[model samples]
Target: MSDPNRPGHPEDQPPQGQPGLGPTPPPPPGQYGQYGQYGQYGQYGQPAQPPYGQPPYGGPGPLSQDEITWGSAAHWSALVAAFVALAFLGPLIVMLTKGTQSAYVRRQAVESLNFQLSILIYGIVSLALCLVLIGFLLLPIVGVVWLVFTILAAVRAGQGEEYHYPLTIRMVS
Candidate 1:
């Protein structure tokens, strides 16, 4: 089946920058594509050629599901694990599940889990220390600091950024 998001058949795509001679124009509106409504070019608009070495293919066609899965899971695992015990297990499972299965996903999930666990431990320590203070009002402030750390890490990871957790216990690679 022709991909609705894309156009024409895969075999018909001409090499980038080399539209085969006698190229056919995209179908006008009201014409039914095997997929759906045509966009800028039509059912099989021009091959989405991107500048060389710029993350390759454009418009979301280039990313494999595995890449997206890894990054997304890793970023969220950190934040989610903080609230849910099951989420705490996310990283451990990912580490054991074989990063080889999908290196990108495995890496992301493990890193996120590690970072979150660290933050959780730090919060506990901070709270205990706060109890020793006169007002003990400093406990919430410490929690907020760690929360900020988790938020920033998650946002960066979501954007495909790689960050290592400081002082994480390296139980798995």
Candidate 2:
């Protein structure tokens, strides 16, 4: 009753309790499936390391106090710039320079720049509407909204939260 699929004699049957299955040995000590060795994998069930250039777990940590302060200043600077009629320049400068120092500053600066650019576009449209006298009303409203939201963004930045402006075109990433 030997199996042609098996090399041995008919008496060479699989051990009892292992019918149709020959005894298979376990992997050698310290060797794992494909990964090569045991220690090659961390403690059982532990997650593998992150790929190159990517941050681990929570990603980059929170900003330092100085970074927060500077980031907040970047947001507030837009408000000051508006008074001098150079709203976009403030955040653009902060974004180009201090941006490299802190992720917080970079984000705040970009957000502020986007908001200012949106405001400028709105202002242009409102001025065009002035031909029908609607610009006279819409212009003031736009100004008020810009002023209020810019202040709110500054406050949020001070509190360490990135404030997203409503109606902002987000021209900068």
The top-ranked prediction according to lDDT is: 2
Q: lDDT by residue for model 2 over 1-173, one digit each (tens)? A: 54767667566667544577765444465354345333325443233454467663436787688878877888788877877888998899899989887777888999989999999999999999999999999999999999999889988988888789999996789
Window of ten residues with lowest summed lDDT in model 2:
38-47
By summed lDDT, the worst window of 10 consecutive residues in model 1 runs over 54-63
Between which residue pairs do clashes occur in model 2?
A: none
Question: Candidate 1: which stretches are off by over 4 Å?
Answer: 1-63, 85-87, 96-100, 134-138, 166-171
The top-ranked prediction according to TM-score is 2
**Model 2 error, position 47 (Å):** 13
Across 79-168, the per-residue lDDT of candidate 1 in tens digits comes to 566576444575566556645565566766777666656655756676777667732675576567656766666677567666676656
TM-score of each: 0.48, 0.68
